[model samples]
Target: MPVFLTIETTCDETAAALVTDQLEVLASVVASQDKLHQQYGGVVPEIASRAHVERILPVIHETVQRAGISLADIDAVAVAYTPGLAGSLLVGVTAAKTLALALGKPLIGINHLQAHIYACRMAAGRDVFPCVGLVISGGHTCLYRCRDPLDFELLGTTIDDAAGEAFDKVAVMLGLPYPGGPSIQKAAEKGDPHKYAFPRALLDDPNTLDFSFSGLKTAVRYAITGPGRHDPSQVKLSDQEVADLAASFQEAVVDCLVGKSFRALEITGFHRLCVGGGVAANKRLRTRLEEEAARRNVDLVIAPLKLCTDNAVMGAIAVEKWKAGVFDDLYLDAEPGVVRRSSALIHG
Candidate 1:
């Protein structure tokens, strides 16, 4: 029962967690920078990185305290160092490396994307590999063939904006709050999903698993504030109008996500499907997935709502690497772009 302390600062959240090799989350803490970035309606990298610098240590300390564990009880220090903001990723990687060195523990660099999928394993309390893993978030919309804990084969990725990004942009258009996912979900609850038939990108292509939300986003923009459309700010829109737009947009995104995910399962021939990331927390998306999975008789695991968003608890995926002796040296550096494997490390 080796316990690992994990840190995550991939984007706007500074998080830390304590978890056992068995995938039990002893404690988890996340410091959100949503208020800091809310005014901007999106994440500002420099602001996010600085916020992480200010909050990372405090988060880790709180997590350890909540877990009721001393530093000596930790077996390894893990951090998600890839596929994230360069400056933010650096904050977590540097913290983990220092802790591992100071405590004489093994250092494990976790892939943020893979850990998102691993959140399924953590929640399921069992193995969930050899499945189609769909990661839908603000920055990434991709599917992978997860053959094992550490082995993932790239299946399809977004050619344009991710599903979550579209939600944010559309939320801004509707004059909603910065985190469009929740705001839109709330609005859609009162609106009509069929008010507008938004485009479902790549839905017609059965062979392709990649997603395209940019077109959908653009369509929403034109529908609301295009040439002939009244300016959103100048025109007083009825509550029903706002709700309708939100509902329609959400329905379109959910349709695409559910449809493609099932298609991925079909192509992979895997009865189990795992979905992760912030967008996966959407209630509509969850309902549609559940309905479809039931109809198809496929075992599905949506990362628990809390784990659906970025958090260090998912970093417990590092335990798999710890057991396999897959350790990273102190020289490991943060990788901002998408990377398939750990060999994409740069010495610090």
Candidate 2:
């Protein structure tokens, strides 16, 4: 069994893992800088990049050690290369390339979004193709039709604000801590979702799979800053106001994602729905997805919490590619944008 060493630095977390072709996760490690970025209320590209540089080597070393494997035992190095901050992606890509070249192993480039989708396989332990994938996070909000592990079709994506981005913005408006999704989710548990009714975007049209959350973000801004506007510093949102706003905001995002995902399942006639990315870890979102998916004929697969963010174990996704002899040279470059690829829809 070939072991693939994977590195993921597509965002604030620098991670590495070792996995076998059978998808057994030997060891996975993540070094998170959430606390470091919290003071800024969001991730600073420079700070994230520097954090990756410092964390990448030690994390990979420990991952291999924990797995009781040597670097020479791995067959390939897979790294998430696209659809993330350029600086952050570079740190992982550069590290992976360095290790691959030094160790004489083949290097594979994995898509960040694809890694997020395939993270389900780690927990599900089986092929979940012909499934609808909804990836919602601070960086992305997209839906795809998956026929297999590697094959994916882009049905729709966010036009402006991603679901997670809206969460952070709304959280800032409500004076929540940084990395707002979790903070908001926690606060909302004590609040009522219907206390403030927020707009639901793109629910009317079946043909339109695209999403827009900027207006809802704007609505929150106006609600806090007051219409016809006062300085943001002029008014402080009460704690109740913040909680209600958070509940309403979280509800709006979850409703849009869950609704559109099922609609896509209906359109594609897929029997399974898979969700991942940072936002998928939300308890409310997961509950709604499970309940809704059960109501339909579709099966629901949610990635484990640790793997939901940019964790390297998702690179177990590279096993099929390794078996198929897919590898790259050390001269690989990071592609930091939503990629359109044909081979993405095939899973197993």
Candidate 3:
């Protein structure tokens, strides 16, 4: 089997993995910048990019060492090139291009969002196509009608803030820790999800599949500090108040995600649903999805918790392209922003 080295520096995580032609992961390593950006309440693009530059090489070396193989054994190189922080993507793409040039091997460019959905296939240990793929993360919240591992048509997307981004901002409002998903989930466990009736924007609009979390985020803000110009830092919230707010806010986000996911399935008539990304690790969201899927008789595949966060293991999607003989030239560049497909292209 040909060995491939895959790099994933799309955001705050510096990651690399060694995989075989058969999708077997020999080794995977990720260097997280959570602590570095924790104080800022969210990721700072410049800081994330700089950290990736510093850690990408070491991460690749560690992955290779763990795999018990040297660079000579690798047959190809792959790196995520699109839908990411510009500087972060450039670091990985530059490194992969350099390695491919030096080793005389083909280079493959992976789409970061597509790779997230592919994580479900990795977890299933089987092909999971012709499904509705929902990717919820700090930077993305969109749905795709996935015809195969490589073919994805955009179904719907967020009009404002992504779900995970809202979580981070709300966490800051409630004095919770950064990387808000996990922190908010933990805090929400002890509170009533119905304590406050947070708005679920666009949920009532069955005609469209778009999501809107900005209003919900603002509602949480007003709940914390009345709809006035008061600093959130000065507002003292008791432990119970924080927990209740977290619970209510989380419920609102989950409602929007679940409602939209099922709507996509209904629209596409796909029996299977695959979900991945960082916020997919939320316990409440996972349980709710499981319940809903079971009730609707939908085949649901969620990436394992370990695979839910940004990591190179999911970049194994590159293997599919490699097998199809799809390769990228050295001119491959990073696309910092997401490019959405027109609604007219959506398949029923």
* TM-score (all chains, Cα) for each model: 0.95, 0.95, 0.98
State the lDDT of candidate 2 residue by residue for 301-320, as single tens digits.
99989878778888788887
Tens-digit lDDT track of model 1 for 52-111: 999988998999899998989999999999989999999999999999999999999999
Residue 270: error of model 1 in Å?
Answer: 0.6
lDDT of 3 by residue, 94-145 (tens): 9999999999999999999999999999899999998999999998899998
After superposition, the stretches of candidate 1 with alpha carbons farther than 4 Å from their true spots are 228-235, 339-348
The positional error of residue 1 in candidate 3, measured at the CA in angstroms, is: 0.6
* Candidate 2 to truth, TM: 0.95
Clashing residue pairs in all predictions, respectively, total 0, 12, 0
Regions of model 2 farther than 4 Å from truth? 339-348
Candidate 2 achieves a global lDDT of 0.85
Q: What is the lDDT of residue 52 in candidate 2?
A: 91
| Worst lDDT 10-window in candidate 2 | 339-348
Q: List the residue pairs that clash in candidate 1.
A: none
The residue pairs in collision within model 3 are: none
